[model samples]
Target chain A: MTDTSLIDTSPQGSTRRSWTFTIGAIVVGLHLVIGLSTLFWTPYDPTAMSGGRLEMPSLAHVAGTDRLGRDLFTLIMIGSRIALIVGTGAIVIGGLIGIAIGLLAAFASRTLDDMLAAGLDILIAFPTLLLAMLIVASSDGASLWTAIVAIGIANSAIVARLTRILAKRVLRMDYITASRISGTSWIGVVAIHILPNIWPTLLVNLALQFGLAVIAEASLSYLGLGTPPPNASWGRLLQEAQGTVYTAPLGAIAPGIALVSLVIGVNLLADGLRDIADPTRRRRR
Target chain B: MSPLLGIESLTIQAGGKPLVSNVSFSVAPGERLGLIGESGSGKSLTALASIGLLPDGLQASGSVLLDGRQVVGARDRDLVPLRGTVAAVVFQEPLTALDPLMTIGRQVGIAVRRRAKRDGHPTDSITVMGEVLDLLDQVSLPQPQRIAEAWPHEVSGGQRQRAAIAMALACKPKLLIADEPTTALDVTTQAEILKLLGQLVRERNMALLFISHDLPVVAGAVDRVVVLRHGSIVEQGPVATVFGQPSHEYTQSLVAAARAFDDALEIAP
Candidate 1:
């Protein structure tokens, strides 16, 4: 047998980290810095009609101005913050609910497990956007938290399905039996063995879910069922800029660029994380 | 002495079809019993049912008494206390038997801590680690400290099996059910693991239910043998009586095959 100890003694060996991870991290990091900076400072007030309307990119206004004369750059920066908030919030809510349901399904009695599996399949098959729209339309109309809750609930079905499949696979392994035979409780088994083994894959899936959540939030905002006025959501900016696109394209283009970059960054990060988290993939490289 | 493990007419069914039909066996305290069966013979299922660890969709009927506790139809919570304390199992594949994400030491430490808590001894991290190393040493693993820190993939198959044995030993179980523990190892490693298992069982006075398909291996480890075919017990007797003068046709064929293989090995240039 090949002795892996010599080469793979350290968990975080030098060759394990790849350039894909580096680039993705940098891109995500840049967005995070720009987004977080908005909490303390922005060059121009994002909500104020403080510049010449429909101006092109120039020294006075970096990304130019919107039809309402708000600083496009400031709005884009705030959009980053909103995107991050919605993504993080949605994942947290989705992950907790999904993981709990998935684990319950995994450890549940045969009849209950089947019922949960069928329920989850139906939920997964339903369109996420349509579900989000329904949720937004039903209760306390679209604010930031409402949009977050809607997207989060929409995201949970997919997360639950993935978690269920992954958890079941982990559960089938002999170690789980060994754990139980070792007197570890079911809760302890989940906490110690099942979760730790499945988290890397789950984490990669959650990162992709984070990207979807951002896009879903943007879509909701565009439909006017998301974060309302003065918040300057990228989708809201796109909606307002749709009419003035011919005269001034930057208004539409700036927010679109911000949204695309963040999503792409997240996707790349997920891809890189999968490569890093899986030792087989790392070894192959 | 009463049997540490007693299975009387155990029947395991999946999807209303019986997989193991009316199987019966008993293992007395400190006795070594070999369960001999080929793949799909339900030996593993019988072992699992003995501890109430049978997979979902497979229903077990009849009595499985482990240390006087009813394992058949027993609630998981009720079985939890009995497992690890009464009996601990070392599975066939050592690599998959251990948690890949955890270091060998930590996994063994969990068992050690559980045993300590059950015995109402000190369960602090330092004491647990100390006991973990002790178990590793008891398994005769070279450089116990290094083995403790190693991941499952980092070690050889034998070492991994040794570590798995260490984990099983950590619980200080009265009965050690080895379900083909040495089957996944190389020929040399298999012999070493079997030797280690025999020595440990002897040293700790733990009853051993050694399950395997290899006739010679089972004959060497166990005093008595239970031959199973297609989930049914064909014949069972003292290892010498059964292997020397087989009564059942299946057992006779098995003995013949083992003898043929042994002769082939002896004649090899």
Candidate 2:
């Protein structure tokens, strides 16, 4: 133990810096709670629609009614569930796959690194949405889970590429070399030394992926490649609103604003994290 | 009695270039041998190659006997069980040698527990951690308990170097290959570290292979100094003899350079 390692007990120690991380964690926690709650609860049969069209905001139907006569606010909340689930699902699925492939590729050598980087170069060159749509379209539409799986698989490629690059860079650092020479097994070196050091980078990437997943899920839903019809999603609402855009116009605008606002919140949150969690940026602060 | 480490006809190739070629050395028990050479003269490479840590794309070949058993050309995986047990190396840059993420106590405790195994019997791990705190105190680290919780980034350069030394000592290694351990320290700290290392070597009865470019530091440390030039030993004898009357032309030039360096540093203040 060295005296220098003692944490400062001043009221403004590491706690202040950890505040944003705490908030971000809560936001993500709420996302999971709200997302999981949908498996059990909802205001109404969201797709029931009361068999009527073009209704206004009322106690019976708060947040008014869409052109398809669905509850607006309830649908938005439910859409929140769908967005969070698909976003988390895709990012996690792709994130794990990416991390495994990346670590292995990076540990292999420059030849393997170049091969992976070249493959990712081609993947990154293509638009992510377009790839998701292509895969989702080719799959059977009756199965909503199938769409998520397709999109999730498509998204994993990018994450794997990113993790590979991060692993490669981390492997070159002195701590990693030292760990290796200390006779730590390669797996131990990767798990303890290499992974912990790159965690901030991984967290930032996770945030970025969460935002992208939300938009991608929305786009897929909007194209009728997302959560099945009568299954209340903002993307589905937007799709149904296309016919009455000239009429209520509110239906079109509501889901549109909802999509943009949610995406904006996630992006702002991710952007704030990107600035805060970054060691270089934190050092500047 | 077998020497702690035996390097016979060792060669190292880095990026298609021979860094150290056909080098041989040995460290008898309780004996300190200095491998003295200027930068790029391959002394450090030879030390690293003995421990199988020359980095990627660099290759080491020939017989390396630790405790008189062959380890040269051994796979990296096979080397894990031997580190700090048979041989431990203290690198040139201690600040980088210790992980920035781990505490000094934790780092030393790892090696201490790993090597405390006795006759293949089970051992209590926490007992070794307490011993690690003692070693931290041994290295003159103030506030041993709290210091054990802190990261490497929090320590000063000299303190970090001492902690690195503490880690090397944790496993009670038979052979210690220190590659210029005091190069990064202040003169006062350098002198203190040299004296402390010298004392520990005699107390533990361990073999020491000390590598350095500075003649004065080496002069104060090892019992016998082996001078190298262009990947070959140019002089080998007692440190006093080499410093007082060098036989090889290269060794004489090095002695002259060392004298001039001391004179220059003396007048600078």
Candidate 3:
């Protein structure tokens, strides 16, 4: 009876199984290829007015031309590159600063831990974009580096809060005590035991944060608090395309699709990665 | 010979409420002492205090001298050198005691490496691996090679406890504290672990501080027993005399319970 039921469910079960990771990877990978290829060549100089204004999709001007008379395809390729750069840079900055602060909070004394926790809570309560804008406004003027640093600093509070909670849970386990009793130093315990145990979860969160950073960067650019002209950030493309939307609808829709797809791809990737990293969850399915 | 562990007027408190109050006891070198109590009686807290490993927000007052070193109120840094050298602990739950991510061999190897480095011995990978396997073998774990390669979850409870014992013994500590080490195992596995622990302690000539709620298990493992009730010592004496003729009402009740359990087992067809 069990065998027959298992056989009947096999085909349906295979269909029901998740394909998010594969789809996410493919979408992200396509964007990456387009982004990287821009380093070597683009059909035309993205910043130059090489095409007629508001040209419809054609072999010469695929994705058409924007109001500025530049190839929309070239603008999007450059936009993908900037998006990836900001995502990678923000996540790197956030991961280092956040993990360090979180570990410190986990190991801190009662009073100190409470102070740090409260401080992190306040930082987290602020909107990421607003916080990024404040940072960007305060530190010189808006540029690619400024936006990256601002978004990173703004995102760190959430990451730190997550790391602290996870590290504290790991700290309470008996193996930690056993490790200590075995003469492992505090630093050694953090590196060997705490970090390895918590990293799988952290990796998933960081992937999600990557998507958020991409969106945050675009938002900053849209508000003119991001990279200046000629950089062609997706947010700027969407903003620039808005005036010409009725004449060349593709101009506005192109960047919008790019932004949505990247974020959705990363979110799906994170969801799939979680299942892969956690064996118990995989076994349950 | 000097006592390996001496606790005088030791009181452990959490949030200002005393959990183990004014608990006093001493264990001489090469002696086997049992701390028997019911759950929440503070037996585990006493063991933790001895090693200066009491959990956060819990403070231990008074003196706990282990190998002539003060454990009460000692800073963690000050206690590091003494840990796994002067004394080591085997906690109750073996599955939780060993790191889930690490292999049994690697965990044991870490302890061995630390001990070797402290003693100024060569800490090459080969020497450490050899020592890890030796310790696993000493614990009588079947196929030390296979057991060494297995993760904690892959092994049975009894094997895990044996591996835990091996990790503790890796330090060659002067004092070994087994805090309800076999409580999580079945009756058969418990007896086997108790036997393995007894053999290891005898072989090393290390002082043993066995903590358990099981009266029969404690009686079989130690020379003297300290009975704790509500975080205080109700009675303490040689196991034979204490079990044969108890003085405190609490001690008498504990003795009666053990006897009743044994009687039930004997009458069962």
Candidate 4:
């Protein structure tokens, strides 16, 4: 019913949108290539040491060596694998749980709504980082995924709250009313009428949530609150490089740049989805 | 004669405030009864309450009977089976009454399919489409198939109302509750719609509960007229008796207000 060619163009009439898309595609492409290459081989084992520590861009090490004499380039590649995994995992987990709670609160009126809202409010009131740290302390040590799950759990209340408010408003719209008037039950109204319209909102919101999740997981790893040693996350690599900030600053600078670039790429991708998913953008076009 | 539709002492309270209180009305099969009143006069509330479709938080009492079977106090589970089988509705703001996202054809097909599934009636989707086209033809919608394929927004106000009439008829319900079905339409479209509805009622021998604020439209379209003011039945009788000689002061005032507007429509004071 719609022309694919028209959709190919980004919502921002400006060329910046296309440039951002190209940059995102390249970063994502590099991330995938870097991750999958681990299944095959890196120039050197990511954790293996070469001749000496702080060996700058030698013929053998490619991107130079860390304080521990580990190849910085291989560490960067391996770190991306964790970043992609945690980022994707957190969004899926948080999005699904949040949407379930949201739909329940929106459709089930009064007492159920109050119960869910109160639960979310309590969770939201707690400090996310301190709560995650406390959880990690109280529980066993966290893995890369544990940090991701903790951050995702901490942030799900925002998604749930936003989804509930949006869903409740949508529940009162004429289309939903028509569904009920047509002999469709409340469950039917939500599944058939409400869900379809709110899907675009969910998608755009997911992109933003995933971006935040990546940053959270990376920070926790850097603070030694994430996946234990021998696991390389962007945060852990950056943490390991802290002692070498003087002579071999590239040890910190390389992973640091990777973390910022990945975050920037995800945020840009989210902006793109926002423009496309926004219904108002349709009229603008 | 058995009334095709009967509402007895229908009381509806919204937040402890009565919207329709102690209201009673009935219509025989093949008969048309107009419930006339000003805006917010409980006429529409009575119609909605009769069908057990009033919004939540509204309390309803009294008996609504269809084919002599009480329905008003019936359970939610029980009320649904009778919905499209025994009755259907046509509402004001035709486009809003319809699902804007669904095609008119699908809407009609849904009603027909629901009825056929419930009753074990013969139902080929194509046959149902043909039947819908026939209804659209009956409502005088030119290019019925094209109109059926169009969304509610694509059509003019008149076509949307015609589509609504077609939907209300899709299940072949014996009672059709038309609440301000013509109020949003233009004059020529209003005249055509009222005439079409009148003809449909006669042709199918169905009972009609016509709710509207316009006195002349109701006067011309119905056999009996019940005047309501502030949730109470003020006056009622054979259309000629009630309109020619209203028994209650509120009824007279309603007629006077209607007459003052020169058959266009009166703004109720």
Candidate chain B TM-scores, in order: 0.98, 0.92, 0.98, 0.93
Docking band of candidate 3: acceptable
* lDDT of each residue in B29-130, candidate 1, tens digit only: 999999998899999999999999998889999999999999999899999999999999999987789888878899999899888888899999999999
Candidate 4 chain B least-lDDT 10 residues: B260-269
Better of 3 and 4 by lDDT: 3
- TM-score (chain B) for candidate 4 is 0.93
Misplaced by over 4 Å in model 1 are A1-18, A271-285
Q: Per model, how many backbone clashes are there?
A: 0, 5, 0, 0
Give the CAPRI class of candidate 1: medium
In angstroms, give how far residue B229 of model 2 lies from its true place: 3.1
Tens-digit lDDT track of model 2 for B1-269: 77778888888887767777788878888899999999989997788777777767888887888776677788777887776676777777866877665667778776666666633534566787788889888777777776676667665777777788788877678887788988988889888888888888888887899999999888888899888888877778899898888999999999899889889989996
Over A17-116, each residue of candidate 2 has an lDDT whose tens digit, in order, gives 4555556556666656655777798676677676357776678876678766667766777888888777778778877877887787888776877788
Instruction: List, for all models, the DockQ compared with the true complex.
Output: 0.56, 0.41, 0.34, 0.21
Error of 4 at B208 (Å): 2.8
lDDT of 2 at A201: 73
Q: Encode model 3's per-residue lDDT on B149-248: one tens digit a residue.
A: 7667666788888999999999999999999998899999999888988888888899999999999999999999999999999999999988999999
Which candidate wins on DockQ? 1
